[model samples]
Target chain A: MTAAPHPGRTRRTVVLAALLALLAVAMLAGVGLGAVPVGPADIVRAIGRALAGEARVPGDAVIVDIRLPRVVLAALVGACLASAGVLYQALFRNPLADPYILGMSAGAGLGAVIALTLTASATALRFGVVPAGAFLGAVLTIVFVVRLASLRGALDVTSLLLAGVAISYVLSAMTSFVMVFFRESMTSVVFWMMGGLTAASWPYVWMVTPMLLAGIAVPLLSTRELNLMLLGEDRAAELGVDVERFKRVILAAGAVLVAAAVAVSGLIGFVGLMTPHMVRLALGPDHRVLLPASALGGAVVMVLADLVARTVLAPVEIPVGIVTALVGGPFFVWLLVRRNGHR
Target chain B: MSVRLAYEAATVGYPGVEVVSSARLRVAAGEVVGLIGPNGAGKSTLLRAVTGSARISDGEVTLSGRSLAGLTPRERARRVGVVPQQVSATFSFTAREFVLMGRHPHLGRLQQLSAADTSLAEEVMARTDTLRLAEEPVDTLSGGDLQRLALAQALAQEPEVLLLDEATSHLDLNHRMQVLDLVRELADAGMAVLAVFHDLDLAARYSDRLAVVAGGALGEAAPPPAVLTAGMLSEVFRVRAVVGADPVTGAVSVTPVLREEAVPAAGLGSVLVIGGSGTAAALMRRLHLAGYAVSAGALNRGDVDQAVAAALGLEHVALPAFGEVDPRAEAAVARMAATADAVVVADVPFGRANLGNLRALAEVAPRVVFADGFRGERDFSGGEAARLAEGLAAAGALSVPGDIDSVLAALERFTAR
Candidate 1:
């Protein structure tokens, strides 16, 4: 069908393009601004030489092996979490919804600890056992939460959030118990729980990139149904939306996104919560613009946050989750205060 | 006109409980049907059954002779548009965007709204008088404006059948009229409409046929004049109301008979209220509610007192508009005044047509209670009515200041004697 020339479409297109440019700059900075700082031309030459199977430069190993994968992985995880945030917020019609609010992080953390305790060799962990366990745990936890929140085929959003919080507490306690029992793996578990991109690698990036793409694309295509959902379920249904089936599909997609992000980055917080809010504040709540804009905005925030995490203390790397919360928490509070002041 | 929407003996509710049973309704093209009932009488449930939100457990709801059970929600929505009582929006969409969403059922999953759809949204907004609000955020609108926006959205659907569930309840009087008038215009243009109204008078005024829902069953749908009656108001609505044609608009007007439980016992005595031109309406109502058998006389046919007297079902004498009180009306008043235990003369102006009523009150002088109290410039009978009032006062007729309470007190003292 031919598109009508809408007045809002032009502004939305400009905003999306601007966000894409910002995301590219953040990724470039993430790849070049570390301890072994590489310039833009040197970074490009390194990628080109690696693709052509030529000889390595002095910083080629640092660019290709470390910073490139780390930046790519951060972008994928950020997009996944932020897109999942948009989906959950629309599904619940609640402003406070986030990617990890449904106990997915706690469940994934528990699963990773169990896998860490079970595996005796580091090679097994390198071969994708821990990420697999984390992905499975996150998906199962979301399914359990969804089932618990449904009553007679209708999903109650309030009960869903309440059950998620309760399940998160229980799963975290179980993870702590396992950590205390397996003292040798306690440091690894604690570091993972704080959430970092330190395990970023080529295999990890390849595995999660497809899931993140799918997570963003499905919701982007279903923006009409997502918009209808903001009008409330009954009204949306009356207006021809299959609300129950749509909810199931959206919840499943959100589960995949959060599971994929948590599997690689271990429990990154606030990117999911703050990215959508920022994009929505700048643009509007129309999911057609919101989903893609938030995905890009999230990538920018994550890449920059990850950069600060590794370089701010020289050799000592703070968790990326700590940086996001420290930066995002105050920014979100300021946005809220400013919004309330306008009203 | 063909029936565009029909509920064929439908029993609708959720699982294991029936909210409305054995309901049969037909809304044909080019007509508006009003559904009215008390709270919890399942009026809204029946409307929901048409949209498949509430299930029709036993029978079927059909759209244009096709069973609604076989239709997809999109197909049903393409044919029917519903404006609910209220909608609480969670996000901030412009009013134009909200209206454009009503075109959703006609578009494909990934299709954008065409230019025609945008213009149609504008058209509907204009019809609902909400064009100025097109750029305003929907969450910032008042309740009435939101309700109108909801109507505009439903109209943007361009459905063959429209359903409104108390959609105008939040609107003020002018907006209510404007909305319903537009609904009437749409019905005239061949759109079938089924509206649920809490305002009985508005329903009686706008509906081509009114269907009553009471005691879990749907009553027969008929014209407003046939459906809105005293018996139906008492039986179905639990109200003692006087249902009559409005004196000016010729529409059905309902005046409730509010009798307090602490009112004195009936058959107290007979009271003949001799007045006209609306001077005796309040006194007549007070005496009637105070257990007196009240009658009025010689009122012009189109006068306010005549309408009030007819609505209260009082025994009275009537005259033609601007006509003198003839011999038959005068004789009827004389007979009523002779039998009445007390005669009440209201503070009506002394015009030539009603001068005979004052003469009749003079004949029943002992039981006369003159409530005129010479308050205003009431004399217009060439000083004859003034002389009659003085003679009546000299003949031991009680004089009360022109208010119902004092008249009732004088009547009570006369009854005690």
Candidate 2:
């Protein structure tokens, strides 16, 4: 309780400060930068004018209406993906695992594809299509993963990963087959497949932010259990962490986050895989630090990618997925090289 | 602070195979209970069952007359703490964090650490001599250090009853003694401790009561001298041995008698064995099976391996350990070694405190062979065995491989010799 410079508390303080600063910059840049090139002052003015019931800024209204929702949605999706990544990595006690390693994304994608195919004929279901499909897919995948992994008395991570990978590949192949069969709906499906925030609206932001916050907060509270799990399941159980129930809860929570993200913007890769690891390298392997940092770091990466996606061609657009792949691939290459050399 | 633990009609094992059945065990508070058994005796299974990590199958465990079945996890944890057989951490949590986990059962759901709980954890860590490691990662701990850390974690729980299953198996002699001393101190403080031990002498010296489990049944559950007798050991452990009180500590001491296989089928050569305890049993078994006429001496009859040699009807010359050597027994050993094709000395203990046995072996054998003891520590009597081994090696005696398989291979090499 003394305000003395304790090393542990000081380090946590420094890390929290740095993460806040990064998030602030990411938010500002996401609001200000776009093909229309609104400056930070005008962006602020437009937000204030809209709040003050004056709906007139030369091109500022377009930025708020179009780009702001997409940017906000990207941040929500990114935070969800990264925090879900943190949970899965800690739950399995494997550094290489990610949010989608549980098959939630592929299952969600398959469900979305089926919905799209069904909705093409029944045009009345246009608004209900993607989110409904994603939720159903996530719930189904979690059930399958849990059932397959349960052997003897408890669920195991190694078996869960194997089952997840098998189900994911099967679902992916089926999705590809469906895409080929319904070539007439190819453009709309391809847009979802490309992982863009183009369709993001204010209503979507309201839906996702609360879900992402819950995903982040729940896992943060259970950081100690995740730490115990790293000692192996039997040891964890001996130490009073209900190892079986913890696994079920974490898997369910991770699925909900990933399914919710895919519900808005189809599968976005690398954020889930890279952000937790990057945080671990910086903050050390404690889940209390790693989980929140992953959420903030994922938002930063996604927002930056969104800015480039909207502005790189200036009035011409590239899908945000292309920008994420472009940035994340080289970043991942450097990470792998540095990690390999370090070992 | 007295910890009374009881297990009644406890049946434990895998899904179908019951290893321990209907075993009733009771230990009064502040008593150090030792559970000793042979390799497959289900001692560990009973410990796990009591800890509630393993299912009870059909029985009940009670701490202080409270049924363990009815207690919540947190409630049970407050009464009992468990130290498992092996400690491994796949993630590197700082030692402080690791020990703090012991306070889990004491904390309410979603409750952060209270100031009192943190202080209790630190106090326990210091008492366990694990405070030095508080900031260090648990994964980076050495085996001894890790065991102590594990002890700290259990102690931090501040439970009334402590259960350790072979906790000292990975420790060295010094650390093992230190850890056992700590257990005694904890029991003195009025905590109940039920520990499973492998070393018989350590069990006898420290434990208030010893529980010997063998062949899936309780052999003896009494004070040391009564439980660790020669007859009980031979019947349960299948090794013939003498049991007596230690001169220094007044605790039970064991010396194995030689029990070889039957006399050689082809009489390839005569083997003169100068060894004691386990090394002699192994040497007797290997040499006799390899078709050698066996004769052994410089050991007492109550020594378990000597009984083994007697059972195989080997030409044995035994001597009593209490008084001066018998001149006739000495003469028989000399004659046996002189007539033999090879003389094999197993990794037997020889204290400078007792030099007559080594001098007699040295005088009789033209070729002296020795096997390495565990980790080459040379048992409790260190310098004397090494110097004797050095002399034998200089005199062109073969130093057989230290491990069991290698010992058999060395006998095959001797077949050609």
Error of 2 at A130 (Å): 3.9
Per-residue lDDT of model 1, residues A1-343, tens digit only:
2245577678788988999999888888999998877888888899999999999978789999999999999998899889988998998887657866678777877776677678846754643777667767877788888788885477776688788878888988998999899887788778878889998899989889888877677788889889889998778877888777888889878877887888778888778889998788778789989998999888888999899999999789999989987876786568658757966
- Candidate 2 interface CA RMSD, Å: 3.4
Best candidate, TM-score: 1
List ranges where model 2 is wrong by over 4 Å. Answer: A1-14, A119-129, A142-166, A181-184, A313-316, A325-343, B1-3, B50-52, B213-220, B229-244, B255-417
Compared with the real two-chain complex, what DockQ does model 2 have?
A: 0.25
TM-score of each: 0.87, 0.78
Q: List pairs with backbone clashes in candidate 1.
A: none
Cα lDDT tens digits, model 2, B1-417, are 343898777777767777877778887778889999888798888877765566777787887988878876668777778787788865667888788888877776677666777777788788777788888888788877788788888887888888898888888888788878988999988889888888888889989889888766765478888888767776677765557668799888876553323334587777687776646876776677667788786666567666667655577766665433466666667677778766776777665432444555665334565666323465456666567656656666666666656665655555565
Chain A TM per candidate, in order of listing? 0.88, 0.85
Best by lDDT: 1
Q: Is the docking of candidate 1 incorrect, acceptable, medium or high quality?
A: acceptable
Residues A174-219 of candidate 2: C-alpha lDDT, one tens digit per residue: 8889999999988877788778888888878877776676656667
